[model samples]
Target chain A: MKIITTVKELKEYVKNIDKSIGFVPTMGALHQGHTKLIKQAREENEIVVVSIFLNPTQFLKGEDLDKYPKKDEADKKICQLSGVDVMFFPSVDEIYTDDEVSILAPCVRGFVLEGFSRPGHFNGVLTVVMKLLNIVNPTRAYFGKKDAQQLYLIKLMARQFFMSVQIVAVDTQRESDGLALSSRNVYLSKEERQEALKIPQSLHLCAKLVSKNIRDRDEIVQKMKEILNPLELSYVEILNRNFEVIKEVELGNSVVLVEAKVGSTRLLDNIWL
Target chain B: MKIITTVKELKEYVKNIDKSIGFVPTMGALHQGHTKLIKQAREENEIVVVSIFLNPTQFLKGEDLDKYPKKDEADKKICQLSGVDVMFFPSVDEIYTDDEVSILAPCVRGFVLEGFSRPGHFNGVLTVVMKLLNIVNPTRAYFGKKDAQQLYLIKLMARQFFMSVQIVAVDTQRESDGLALSSRNVYLSKEERQEALKIPQSLHLCAKLVSKNIRDRDEIVQKMKEILNPLELSYVEILNRNFEVIKEVELGNSVVLVEAKVGSTRLLDNIWL
Candidate 1:
């Protein structure tokens, strides 16, 4: 595996290659979830490129920008083993300059649920993702649905910008016990980890309710809150693929989402029916 | 020249073409200035594509968006004669959807000169240009130096976003009388047209002063303001290639810019030393 750092070298390298490239962009702390994305990219394309840059713009002032997990050495090893053709690990300075142009999320869709809890978060995510996408110039880029809102917004951006790359949405990789995989999962203490399971459990309960023909969004959410009981729940939303709230779950077209605070750590989980 | 009206068709058309493409994006009513850009693009690349999009976002509230010039039939003829391979003309609905991601111009640099006169103008220009660039996916894109700040901001955005296209800046096309060619020149009545001569004349005087080894920026600006007297002068300033205010004119690296209103018609002119 070739490890690339600078933007110049990556551009020259991508220009010379004559193959369909698959890309997976991640904030480095490569776990099974990220590897799932990389492995899929490896299997699909002639060359797979992975970028591991912990973008700082996505974090708000009091958020965990400082405390966000890092496992650079392990990440490099995993990318090598996963058959990554090129690994772009750019520095923060390489990705951002002093107060340059930026991307702004939509006024309505970009400010709901996750966006409401963390304003301007998607803007930063979008800004960095655009930079990475332009730098990589991949044939198809993969993004895990663990960040369903992010995936949706990114797909929206790609379409809105007329970008040529295909944005492939990968399923959310999860722990066997149902907790969705996240880089922030490490921030959870032993007891907090157990409390975090309610996030996924609530989604599972919502799914079961939907399967039982209980289509009412309010009732499903009410039952979900019971499973989420004492935890500080941010929101339990049932929205269509368009991210608009629907009165009834429309099976294959609906997404049930949950976000809850387990002590100081916030956990998110969703089920796409 | 083939006319493409939809984004999907344009994408497909660009995909099938294996040759290098040069692009020139315009808000119709093509004048000598636009043709010059297209003619240069024609000479540089194997394929040449031109877009006639009157991007509404670039105009501020109460600006000339509604009253903006348009000569669609004439523009098509000009492109056909200029050897354009393809011409994309998309409607407002086809290009924009309800509430999506947007691009923002830099805070400081974007708010000076033309941006200072019309706030948020560069943001709109940058956003539309980004979309068009992505859609065209050309090897090289062309812009005239008449809208100096616009060219600078667009180049800045392409670099900041890591876009692959090479931005080739073309020199400003001018009339025999020294007036810079602009589609908006249609707004200038006979009297206003003659008054507009002061804009280029001031720049000419500034250049002559600089050529005579006069390096003081304030002194040069003072002299230019005198020549631009009696008009509603918005600004007369000098800056380096990076758009930073320089005390002394850097012979090969300075730009002298002027913006003024003649009988309610806004005109812009600049000279690169």
Candidate 2:
């Protein structure tokens, strides 16, 4: 697999390859969730390009911008094993300059859920994703459903901007214990790791409730909150596919989302019905 | 020339054309200035696409958005005569939906000059330009040097977002009496039209001063203001290509810009050294 460290080099490399490319953008420290995205991209296109950029702008002033995990060597190996055609690992300087144009996520959908817990997070995500998408010029881009809000926003951006690439939303990958795989899980201690399982567990319970025709959003949220007892819950929201809150969950068009603090790290998980 | 009014139809039309597209985006009141941009685009690429979108976002509240000139029949004839292959004229609803993602211009370079005078102007310009660029998927895009700051910010957006299209800057077109050609010039009464010539005339004096090795920015600005006397002058400033105020004219890198109000209409003109 080819590894690129600069935007120009990556674009040049892409230009030489005449194929339908699939792109997967991530923040590095690859986990099972990231591999799922790459594997799907690999299966769908002649070339799969994955970008690992720990963007600084997405993190707030007091957030983990400086201390965010970086497992570069391991990330490269994972991409190589996952059949990635190119690994774009650009430095902050290479991808961004002093004062440049940026993409802002949808004001309502982007500012709620993940955006509310961490304001301006989706702006950074959308900005970096746009840069990666333009550089890769992919025919199809893969995004996991694990980041439900982000996936929705990206799809919205692609449609809103008239970008040509097809956005393929892959299903979220989970651990055997039902915990959603996240790079941040590495920051969890043994006890905290166990506590993180409560996140996905509550989401699963919400799904089970929906399956039983318990469609009331408030009831589902309350039940999930009870299951996530003693944890610092940020929010438990049940919204339609458009990210609009609904009184009753509409099957195949609804999602239950939760964000909570497990130890010092924030964990987010959601279930699409 | 084919005129498409919906985004879906335009995208379909673009997909079938297997040629490099050169695009010129405008607001529909075709003047010598706009024709110059369209004419250049026609010359450079296999297919030329011109979009006439009076993007409301670019106009601030109470900024004459409703009264912004629109001469559709004349513009269509001009495009046909200029050899444009496609004319994309999407409605506001067709181009935008409720609560959409937006493109934000850079904080520094985006908010200088015209940006400083009309805050959030570049943000609106960049956002719409980004949408149009994505929709057209042009190989080369044409922009007039008349709106120097707008051109610079668009170039910044393209680079920052890693868009592949080459941005070609066409020189400003002018009237016989040295007034920079603008659709807004139509709003000028017979008296206001004569008064508007002072804008371009001021830039001419600044250019002569620079040619004579009068490098001091303030001195040249002062001289231009003398010629623009009795007219309501917005600003007469010398800036580098990056739009930062410069102490001395760095030949080949300086721009003399003037913005003035002729009656109720605001007009801008610039000369690039």
TM-score of chain B of each: 0.99, 0.97
Deviation of model 2 at A243, angstroms: 0.4
Error of 1 at B184 (Å): 0.7
lDDT score of residue B174 within candidate 1: 94
Q: Candidate 1 chain B: minimum summed lDDT over ten consecutive residues — where? A: B99-108
Alpha carbon deviation, residue A210, candidate 1 (Å): 1.2
Residue B237's lDDT in candidate 2: 83
Residue-by-residue lDDT tens digits, candidate 1, A1-273: 999999999999999999999999999998899999998898889999999998899999999888889899999999999999999999999989986899989889999999999999999999999999999999999999978899999999999999988999889899999889998889889999998888888888888888789999999999999999999988889999999999999988998888888889888888899
Quality class of the docking in candidate 1, CAPRI style: high
Candidate 1 positional error at A242, Å? 0.8
* Candidate 2 structure quality by residue, lDDT tens digits, A1-273: 989899899889888888999998888989888998898888889998999999988888998778888899999999999989889888999888888788888778899888998888999989988888999899999988888998999999999998999999998888899888888888899999988888888988898898898999888899998899989988899899999989999988998888899889998888888
- Scored against the true structure, residue B251 in model 2 reaches a CA lDDT of 92
Name the DockQ score for candidate 1: 0.88
Model 2: colliding residue pairs = none
Give me the displacement of residue A31 in model 2, in angstroms: 1.3
Q: Summarize candidate 1's per-residue lDDT along B61-146 as a digit string, tens digits.
A: 99889999889999999999999999999999888998879998988889998999999888889989999999989999999998
Candidate 1 fraction of reference contacts recovered: 0.94
Residue A118 Cα positional deviation in candidate 1, in Å, after optimal superposition: 1.7
Residue pairs of candidate 1 with colliding backbone atoms: none
